[model samples]
Target: MIVRVFGFSVIVSLSALAVAFLYRGWTGLALCAILGILEVSLSFDNAVINATVLERMSRFWQQMFLTVGIVIAVFGMRLLFPLAIVWITGGLAPVEAFRLAMNPPPDGADHFADGRPSYEAILLAAHPQIAAFGGMFLLLLFLNFVLGNRGLTWLSWIERPLGQLGRLDQLAVVIALVILVVAAEYLTPDSTRATVLISGILGAVTYLLVDGLSSLFQRRQPGGPDTSSVPGPPDGDCADRTDMQHGEIRSGEPARARHRPAPIAAAVGKAGFFLFLYLEVLDASFSFDGVIGAFAITPDPILIALGLGFIGAIFVRSITIYLVRQGTLGQYRYLEHGAHWAIGALAVILLVSIRVEINEVVTGLIGVAFIGASLASSVRANRRDGRHAHHEAVRTH
Candidate 1:
């Protein structure tokens, strides 16, 4: 499974290295390698979150994530998205934007020979909107997880109370908006406040629309949204343990429904489309920080896309599948919780970064810390459960 998943990453890495070397010799290759590593470090939590969503998707959609989805992620978000932003905001034609990106003027030096702003300058100027949009989107994702009513609690002290608050409708939305407003009005520069606010509002609205559509499609499913299939801690508390075990798909749906594979397949196809859309948007949100941060290393759009977009994106998708295949979420139940916690922190960091720059290394460290702690905790829990089961068996005998 490891080879099956990561073989592509290896190939992509080699290809990126070669492309970089050919483009500008060893220095370019070195930059590409660094960017690739940076992307992987930054996006590890993204892989975890993707796993949570992908686990619930159909096999066909899962395949799409590997195939067509990678293409969209690499080219669409990494390449075209930045160019489009430059085109729209800088009032440059797409071709002109691409040219500027490919051949940016040196820092404090003019290569364009024209007074036009370089790609990096324009992109950096648009940082407020990018930060606002990505931060709010991620903030909502984190709130939805904590504010959800799932019975299991890794951080029982805090999560239990938050889960209680889940009884209130639109709690996540309200909190997200409040944060957005605070960031825009108080945290951001006055000149960019309006842009930040609008972008943040749009981010929150986009989340609502996508989540609502996903829920709507889920309900339209033959069996409806199988809450059991949600990829986190089991649905019920430790006491009322009657629910399906983690990772078990409910099996009691009508066999006749199964027999009519065509309609059922059609329904699944429709459902998967929305889920796929959600995944892509989620991917975009995850990449926004990395994309913005990549400018710190090199503003060469081609290099960013080659290394971060292709190599890093492929590896993340592979890791998502690997986690699912290993049943890591079920095995280490707190992993998903930890990933969401990291996401929450990242969201805050992204927002704060609008005012003050935060190092990408710091962001990566926070996520790895959370996930690492969760893995250690999971190991201890497994040992404890094993011992308890052994004790119970001996007592019964």
Candidate 2:
């Protein structure tokens, strides 16, 4: 399965390269390599989070994610999204915009050297705000997922009123509205206020729409059997318990020990669709910063598309595999906590980017630090548990 997936990805990637080459030779290939790496580096945490969601899905859904999801992400979000922003804000014709993107100005020349603004400059201008909104919204989503339990305690007041809505989808809309107001009042000047407001509103609304659709589908589906197909303790248990003479079998046993009959495959299918949708949203959130950031490196639309799209697709696939083979999420619970927190921080960074440029390197470093720390903590926990297991065995013998 893994080989087939990779083979398919390579084919798709090569095909894209062929098209790019047909349009513009070495320049396109160079763009592909650069953006592919950028997307991978920036979205490392995204892959981890995606893996967490994907693990719950069936094999068929996973395949769908690799194929269809890649197309939408590469074309719709990575390519069309930036183009749409240029069209709406700069008043550029779509074909002309594509032309400008395919043909950037000479090195060191201002993108707007010609009477009109360059496609690259328009693309760059779009990032700061994208970062601001996307970063913040993702942070909020991550917080709700990770610290949602805390609402039962410290944040009861906020959670209580909001909880009345009984659906996170509704809350998403409210948050999007608030962002729109902020963009209008404070983010942009009077002349471009409408553009800023519309963009902000669109960002928030897009997030809510995609995420809400995913959740609705998820709710309609039946959960599959709680398969013990995965090895180890039902999360949160120490490994030592498995070795004891207690009724429970050891951790190494086939997970089938814990398996019950699964729900109907049709139910799994529905659940799978929702899961796929959720992964797509997560990918969008993760990619937004990187996509926007790409403008900083170069304004050429083709370059941005080639770079971001190629890397984004590869990262998505790699993340899926990592999640499946390594079980990173199950193995390192704190990873999720760290990722959520990083996403929250990124949100703040995104919002700030509207007014002030936040470096991509800084953003990447911050996210890596959080996730790395969480991973270290998980390793420590695992080691501690292992020692405890050894001690118990000695005492028992």
Candidate 3:
């Protein structure tokens, strides 16, 4: 089971490492290994967040997400994005940017002897806008997750109050945009302030656009929601005390599943497309930090892509699939909450990092901490639930 899901990732990682050895000997191989480890450690929470989405998708779409999505993450984001950033910011041609990235200046020197800023230096300079955009997008996501009407709550003291406040429509967007504006105005330097604001605004807008389209397509799907239940027997489903009948769709669950007509069933594919699109955009927002921070490990664009993209992205995607396949989220109720908390922490870190210098490893560790605590809590909850069930059986018997 392990090998079946992760076989492709393992193959890709091994092949990439082998190529690295051939390209630059043992030193290159070691660097790639370190970067891969770093990427995985930093992104374990991303896998959790991703699982929350991948579980809702069909098996076919899940396969596409793992295969084609990795191409975008590896080649498009890790490899080409470094070049694209340099090209766009430094007014260099694509070839020049690629060359510059390939032949990076020495560490500790911000500029080449010829006075051009080094590749890492250029990335650092552009960090404000990059952080702003990603920060706002992720902030919105975190807010949406935490503020939604959820069946379970990992942190009841906090989540319950926030969920109540969620009665105010669009509160998540309002909070995210306000923070974006405030951070852009106060955290950023005067020179980059407007740029940061614009980038952050664009990020918020992008999230709204993607999320809105996804919801629209979801609603239009035949098996999707049509109208809310009017009323029902007192002992119906836990949700709304009503049955999911009369064209009602509960959550992401579709009702077709080979029962509906061919044309109506086709809406499943269209709905999956929108979900896929949302996942991709959310993924890009998550990868921004890894891609940018990867320069600190090595400025060589090829190695960065090989380590972070080839090995890390593949393994992360595989982990997402594994969680979905194993029904980890359902079994361990608090995990999704913990992952969202990690995301919220990450969002805050990114937004603050526009001015502050927070180590990427520390940022990653915070996420690990939240997830670890959540895992422990889930275990305790499961044991307690088991005890209650056992006691009830004993008494009844």
Strongest candidate by lDDT? 1
Residues 1-397, model 3: lDDT tens digits: 7999989889999998998898889989998998999998889889988887676567788878987888888998888877788899988999988888778777557898999898788878999999999999889888887777544567989988897887688999999988988897789999999999999999999888877766666667766544311110111222332233434434433221111111112224766787787788878888888887877777778889999999998899989989977878666767877898998999999999999988889999999999999989978887776776677668779
Error of 3 at 79 (Å): 0.8
Clash totals in order: 0, 10, 0
**Residue-level lDDT for 307 in candidate 1:** 80
Clashing residue pairs found in predicted model 2? 35-307, 36-311, 120-299, 131-350, 132-350, 132-351, 135-347, 136-347, 139-344, 228-255
lDDT of 2 by residue, 107-196 (tens): 735455656667767766666556545654575465345333222211245434544543454454465467657755776667656656
Which pairs of residues clash in candidate 1, taking residues 3 or more apart in a chain or in different chains? none
Ranking by lDDT: 1, 3, 2
Model 2 alpha-carbon drift over 4 Å, by segment: 1-31, 111-114, 150-202, 205-209, 224-267
Model 3 regions more than 4 Å off: 225-267
Write down the worst ten-residue block by lDDT for model 3. 228-237
Better of 2 and 3 by lDDT: 3
Q: Could you tell me how far off, in angstroms, the CA of residue 106 lies in candidate 2 after the best superposition?
A: 3.8
Candidate with the larger TM-score of 2 and 3: 3
Residue-wise lDDT of candidate 1 within 300-343, one digit each (tens)? 88899988887889889999999977877767757888999999
State model 2's lDDT: 0.61
What is the lDDT of every predicted structure here? Answer: 0.79, 0.61, 0.78
